[model samples]
Target: MIKTIGFGIGLVRFANAACTSGDGLEGVCRTRRECARIGGTGSGRCVNGIAVCCVVQKYCGDVTTSNSTYFANPNFPNLYNGGTICTFTIRKLSDDICQARIDFIAFTLAQPDANGLCATDGLTITGGASTVPTICGDNAGQHIYVDFNGNSTIQLNIFTGIAANSRVWNFKVSQIGCDCPTRAPSGCLMYYTTLMGTVRSFNYGTTGNAAMTRQLANQNYGVCIAMQPGYCSINWAQTAGDLYSFTVTGDSPTAVTTGTAGTNAVIGALCTTDFVVIPNPTFTGATPGAANVDRFCGNAFQPLTTNSKPFVLTVVNDANEVGDIGNRGFSLDFTQQRCNNVPVIG
Candidate 1:
């Protein structure tokens, strides 16, 4: 909550009259109210020698990005040419004092070049310069803080030298107060898995193949998950199999399935299976996008199990092949939580 208190010139005279008991001692008073009465406001009255003052109050609202700017290299399409810096100023509308946390979401769309491409290789900003505080790698966004210091405005900066055409970039700024606990930095643990099978020609478009089956374990709160087709990159043998169905089960052991076989079957007969699954993944706000991999394909469930704890994550890939030989494969990576030497508050 926010509140403002003050009085105008006329109210000062009224206050002085009440304080002086209507003795006409206005000119001898030092308070602004006294001066107003002596200045000829005859309406001044002393009601029980008490004075009234004006006060105003207002509610605090959401924080907003009040200003944003992008700075590019002066000599684009030339040596050492690219975006140099980006800055944002966020403001909160409130009469009360509050603090805010700022986070920069950056994406690159530039093509790969000898300069190792403008990959989101962690929050480097610039190569070999200085690492950004609270850096969370390239694909994922980085979190920063801006103390209002009881002031009306705050600013944040994101300096970069990445080639301008690599990926798309976006940012989100949120106001955090004492009510929320600060998040801890954790390391990522990646796991790999594989499956194999065979398919018949009839399983093509005419009738979906039920032979292929895939299942992933439920996720934990504060965690995120993603999946992608594997083994497609290599020149592995391909086949026209029946329906390609993938099922994912949550804590309740219920199954959710999607995909079609034959024409819809994953293009590669044998490809690497990739999925991003993390328990208790923290997000700055609502509708946070998947950071490292493709979007989620199965049912979205709470990251925590019924017991209110992290759940064991599992992925099952199933595929079928015809002719003399057939094979299916997959892999997974799990990120582990890491502790940093962050300062503790009393």
Candidate 2:
């Protein structure tokens, strides 16, 4: 097929002796026999030189979220393998008006011909009698927003042929109010932090889509964060008389450098070489192309203060920066706050 690659998580070494920071892994030297001996438990498969030892990921089942939240393909930013079927159900929360919004930033599937039909690996979304058309093939980079009104549950089922594979897709989903005001996204890729926990990215900006996250990424990424940081925001909405403010906080591999940059109230110090986070208020955002956004990086944060949901935040691998960006992955964590009816799509 024209499309194929079980890519994601750059393998530092191969199955047998592919990866080794030094002289061979000392034990796993390019053979199933040697790998099995060292693994000390059972036999091993030397696929592409690396020993198959790690626990394989399971693809199936239900995903319940608090109120508004985000979700993605089982192993996004990586190619989906063959003959695998998985289903995910995003359960609804109480504040949700029985409505859900799914904003797809990137989606791709396998197809053999030029026709619109997807005869290979693909994914489909359905809610009761309503079902999103099965999507496949180069539908990689998109700005699609789906609204499930009058529905209680949203489900996704994906599968690949006996010998088919597909690229990755990423999206943000949240509960919506019966009616609310809305605005167009200033940027393409979006992240909606809710009252739940943290939401991670499939990659970063580069690999999946650039216009939204910032720098582009190469395909061989892992559950690892994108080495290239990008932009994102939070959404806080008020319902009835309930209201709350949130402080954004996160952590990286300590491998990310906190370089020297300008000190604006928005983004913290500049760490062009190290990863940095830039925060901005909704009414006024960091101007495009000018490194003026507030930059914050290092092991911890000062808790970028926010009084509302959907606050725009940016993570960038400054073109001027360099060094051990490592996996570029970071853990986005924030204290729980009460939020709801925040729009995930238009």
Q: What is the C-alpha lDDT of each candidate?
A: 0.26, 0.38
lDDT of 1 by residue, 1-346 (tens): 2222245633423222122224322211123353243232222333322332211111112223221112212232222223554333445555442445433334322321121122322122211111222121132233334445456655443344464433234444444443444321121111112222221110012211122212211211122121113221101112222112221212111222332221222211222332223333332223343333222223222121111122223222222122101111111222222124533322
Off by over 4 Å in 1: 7-81, 85-170, 181-275, 278-346
Top candidate when judged by TM-score against the true structure? 2
Q: Can you give the TM-score per candidate against the true fold?
A: 0.26, 0.34
lDDT of 2 by residue, 57-149 (tens): 123564644332334466655765658676766666554344555555556555422222345666776773333445554443333333444
Model 1 has an lDDT value of 0.26
**What is candidate 2's CA lDDT for residue 300?**
31
Error of 2 at 53 (Å): 32
Root-mean-square deviation of candidate 2: 19.8
